[model samples]
Target chain A: MKILIVGGGMGGTILANNLARRLASELRSGKARITLLSASERHMYQPGLLYLAVGRMTPDELYRDQASLLEHDIEFHVDPVEEFRLDNNEVRTKSGKVHGYDILAIATGSRPAPEEIPGLAENAEQFYTEESAIKMFRRLQAFQGGRIVIAMGVPHKCPMAPLEIIFMLHDYFKDRGMLDKVKLHYTYPIGRVHTLENVAKWAAPEMDRLGITYETLFNLKEVDGAKKVVRSEEGGETPYDLLITIPAHRGMEVIEKNGLGQRGWIPTHRHKLTMEGRNNVYVLGDTTNLPISKAGSTAHFEAETLGENIAAIVKLGAPVRDYDGKVFCFIEAGKDRATYASFDYQNPPQPKAPTRAVHWFKVAYNKLYWASARGLL
Target chain B: MARRTVDARGSFCPGPLMELIAAMKMVAVGDELEVLSTDKGSASEIPEWLRKARHEHLGTEEKDGVWHVLVRKAR
Candidate 1:
């Protein structure tokens, strides 16, 4: 079996490792081949960026070379995916190299692009990506303090990220004794901090306590960089010296270009992650609209099921595993504490509990989870 | 050596680790702390972490699908 996986981030890496280890016997017998494709040589730990932006996590902790994450048996191609030729069961890279597979797994994660926002593209910065977020983090440290606007472009990845940023910024400025000069403004389209209402109820008190100015249900229509003003869909305008934004995210263009994507994402079977319209094709992680948080933990869960289902599909010719869409994310609130929340597709988010222990868990789990995926643990 | 039970059941990830740290602080050396966790990741991860931290991993037993892991504070 030739298994070609596109996108070598959380989902792709996990799938590659799981299959490589589970089918090691088959692989040793020359019965299986796996290929991982991605555009970058670097694999970033994105959740760390929330900490990285506030100097809680070092830049080195947030990125790793892609080859380090995959198993030795899986062939990795560090190049951009240009198109997916479904007819031939092949994916063509930007270099025009075409490789055929019996089964294709698309895990090409989404991109955080703010170019569509008026002045946001020109002046606003994002903490969603490594390069841009690091620049903004550095810029924030040098700032003596000004009107800091942490806003979100619609459909931003990880809806709670901007909220976490503001909370940590409060702690950062408070530590520097410059809290008086810094005014934190948070604006998002959702009526609350997160898409889930129950979470917002619990989080509202923290924003109030921290004195962070937040306006919910406000759409970001435009940003006037020169004037330092941000206009919302409701015609509300706010000014800022710096804009840290979570931009509008879109699926990989190659998938859409190949007619594999619907709107900004590829459609996949809710449980199996199989491509909706294509057989022997699977998609996972943020590349699909799975009604789950586009998070690493969720990807881990999906990878577990997807790997099993794919193996069963090839052997028994049946999809056996179903994704529960479960995800657990630790939200860092500075002050050496974090909150834990678990969300499943079938149920409401469970109540969250904040503790210093969760904070340490977040710190340790980051390393442990990374190590586990690479089998370092 | 004495044994103290940390009721970490229903606690989320990393919470167990933190509770262990705090419990270790309060107890004397050579004391054993047993953590009962419902999170599958924590149940598996705690023993490996104890080994790496040079703490003694007494054992991990499963009951009704819940995990009970015991560790002796070596430090």
Candidate 2:
């Protein structure tokens, strides 16, 4: 069976590795041809970018050469996907190359589209992407004294990430002997500081301790770059010297252009990670609008299931296994401490709980995760 | 003499752990407590945590897609 997987991200790479192990016989005999395509040579651990923004992790630590991470059997194409034809089971590349597949996996991840919001793209700097994070870091470093605003965009990955960065920034300035010279402001569209009110209960007081000013329900509409002003949906304007926007996110345009998006995300069954209304197509990682939060740990859990299910289909045609939308994440709160939140989402409301020990647990887990990614653990 | 049940099903990982910590706070010594966790990780995590905290591990069983982890306040 010819398996063509688009986007060599955390999901795509893990799926490829898992398939290689599960279908070793098919892969060795040339019966199964696996092709993984990506737009870049570097596969970055995006979650690490938050640490990079605050000088906690180096850029080199956040990314690895994709070819080095993959097994020898899987064919790697460092090219962008132009279009996909579901009827023929073929995907066309940006260079006008088309490849056919017996089965397909589209893990093409999402990206921030600042242009969707007028003036924000041209004027306000963003910190989601690697380049933007690095640029914002430089901007932060050069700042002698001024008002710094960290604005949260809606539906972004890792919902609590922006607050973490802001908190770290507060700690950063205090250490630099410029705490009083700079004023920090946070603008969020949500009713609370974080996703859960209980979380905000803890985080709000932390923000207060740092003397940071935050305004909620302030939906960012536009930015007047020339005037250094941002207009919110509530007919209010906030001016700043530096505007670090989280920016809006969407499924990779290729998925949308090919009619893959059901509701701004690839529609997949909760348990199987298989396209709900389609045959022989599976999606993992951030592109799928699952019930859980979009985070790297969710991708890992989904990859573990989808990879096995696909192999079963290729071999014995076993019924697909289900993914329970498990998410394990670390919410970094400066001082080299991180909180681990594992969400097991099911039907019927259940009270949520948070733990302080999660801070140390995340630090230890980070070491293990990177080690495992490099095949060391 | 009495048991307290914390329904943490439908919540995610550390959610069950947090519930256990909170429940331990309110329960008297030797009181039984049950945590219904939907997260598979919790099945293992809770047992390990209880052992470390010197609490008595009653048992764990999967029911209706959730793991019912029962523990007793031993400390």
Candidate 3:
């Protein structure tokens, strides 16, 4: 069996490692082969970008050589898939190489589309990438004090990032002794401060306590960079000296170009973790149109399930088990305090009050994430 | 009668439990497994999962900030 995994993000990497281990004997006997193709040679710890924007972590600390993180037997490549010929059970890479597989897993991941919103890319400060994060940090450093408004769109990766950044900013200015000089306001596209009802309930009063003002039902219409104002579709305009945004997210361009699914998200089986109609093709992480948080943990759990089922199909002539849509994310409430959310498809997460101990654990997890990616933790 | 110790310390929430479940698959129906995890959620979650999977939860104890959850395979 030739197993091809496209995109070496968290989901693909973990799945590769897990499958390599479970099929070790088969691989040695030439009964199975595993290959991974990714866009970059460096694997980034994406959650570190938030810390990067706050000056808590540096750029060099967020990456490792992608090949170094993989198992010895797995065939790793830097050529990214440009076309997905699902009907032919193969994907064509940028290097004009087409690889066919008996079983395929697509985990191309999603990209934050700040350009989707007019004037957002030019005016607003975002920390979705390393360069943008560094720039945002520099902008924050230069501003002495003023109105800093947080604006965001829906269906973005890392559901807790907006809240985490807002809270972190409160502490950032507080530490700089400019808390009283700056007015922090937040605007969300939804009817509440967060997409999840419980999180929104917890955050509204927390913002009120911190004096961080918020306006809900505030869809981002456009930004007037010259006037330093952002007008919402809800007929409200907010002016600011600094604008931080979590722009809307869309799946990778390759997915759309290949006519796979709308907006890059391939229709996937929520439980089986397979492409809706393709039994041998698996969809994972932000690549799947599952109505779950596009967090690393979501990918990790899905990868685990996919690994077991694929290995079973090779050995048992059938597969067992299903992905339960498990997702766990730590909410960094501030620089020193944090909490977490744990839930599945049938259950919604009930986050607790933020605690300092949990914050330290999140700090530790930052370093431990590499180990997790290695499928050891 | 067989027993296995799965020391899953330093792992995050659900990871420890997942490791224990993987171990459960390799053991016999009557085998007992002890999972050691540092994540606070695992202390309760391991037993919760055992209950749902129809496995017998032997006991759970926390020692030096690490939790040890014991269970026996039922099916």
Candidate 4:
């Protein structure tokens, strides 16, 4: 069996590692082969980007060479996939090289679609990418204190990040003795601060205590950088000295170009994680059009089920496992305190109060992330 | 009962933990290493790591807003 895994992000790496470990016997006997295709040699620790934006981490600490994360048994290709020929069971890369696969897993992650929202590409700052996070950090250092808006578009990746950024800002300004001068505003498209009701219940009181204004149902419509104002589709407008936004998110263009995606994301079975109308192909992580937060932890959890299913299908001819939509995320409150929440499709997350212990756990998880890619954690 | 002290103050989460792990690699078995960190997570995480790694955790103490964690390399 020849398996091709696309995208080297959290989902791809974890799946590759899990499959390689579980199918070691078949792999060593030449009955199975795994090939991982990625566009870049760099594997980013995305959660670290939040700390990077606050000037607490450096870029060197946030990324690692992808080669270091893979084992010797898997073939790693550092080439961009140009298109998927699902009808022929083949994948074409940007270099025009074609690879055949018996099984294909599309783990290609999502990216910030600033173009979806007017003026966001040019006007607002974001922490979703390494470059933008660094830019936000520099801008934050020079901020003289005024209205700062952290806005979001619906279905964005890492649903908890904007809230974490706001909390960090609260501590940053308080430490600098400029908390009184800075007016912090957090705007979301939904009716609540968080998608998870339990998380919102835990976070709302904290936001009130920090003196940060939480505005709900304020979907971003346009950003006027020159005028320093942001208008919501609901006819609400807020002026800001600085705007940090979680822009609209969409899957990679290649998926859409190949007609394998709906609105730039591959449609998959909610529990089976199998691509719709394609039995040999599967999808996970941000690439799938699932109503789940596009977080690294979500990918980690999804890989657990997806990996087992792939192994079973390869060995026994059918997948036996089903995904539960499990997800957990650590919410950084401020300073040294953090909280955590865990849930699945059936149950809402019950979050714990912020504490220094949970903060450290998040920190340790970042370090363990390196080991995780190799299937050690 | 520490022969070396690692000050990981002003650093964030895994920073303090990484420092302690690096310090442990340099010390001899049965030798003690103390970590001084301002990151509150270190107060709990360092001991957890020590227990998992099979190292002897002496204890953790807080002084002047800093956490002083003691660990002995137990081989």
- RMSDs, each prediction? 16.9, 12.8, 14.2, 19.2
DockQ of each: 0.01, 0.06, 0.01, 0.01
Off by over 4 Å in 4: B1-75
Per-residue lDDT of candidate 2, residues A266-324 (tens digit): 87776667786778788888888554556677777777777778898889877466777
* Candidate 3 lDDT score at position A268: 83
Docking class of 2: incorrect
Candidate 3 residue lDDT tens string, A173-240: 99999998999999875446875557778999999999999987576778999999998755779999
For model 2 chain B, the run of ten residues with the poorest summed lDDT:
B10-19
lDDT of 4 by residue, B1-75 (tens): 338776656433113555565355456888898888765667876776576556788889999979999889887
| lDDT to native, each model | 0.74, 0.74, 0.86, 0.82
After aligning candidate 1 to the native by TM-score, how far in Å is the CA of A260 from where it should be?
A: 1.8
lDDT of 3 at A298: 90
Sequence-dependent TM-score of model 2: 0.77
Candidate 4, residues A42-158, lDDT tens digits: the string is: 999988989999888899998889988987798999998998999999999988899999999999998888877788888888888999999999999999989999887655788
Cα error, candidate 1, residue A218 (Å): 0.8
> Would you list the clashing residue pairs of candidate 3?
none
* Residue A191 CA displacement from its true place in model 2, Å: 1.1
Instruction: Name the candidate that leads on TM-score.
Output: 3
lDDT of 2 by residue, B36-63 (tens): 7777766886786676556889899998
Clashing pairs in 1: none
lDDT of 1 by residue, A1-377 (tens): 89998888888888888888777777778888888888889888888877777777888987788898878888988987787888888878889899999999888888877876787877887777777768878888899878988777644566567667777888889999998999988885544565555666777788888788887645577898778899875457889998878787777777667777653567677677778778788888888755556677767778888878777766677878678767777777765777867866544566565778888887898778677567433
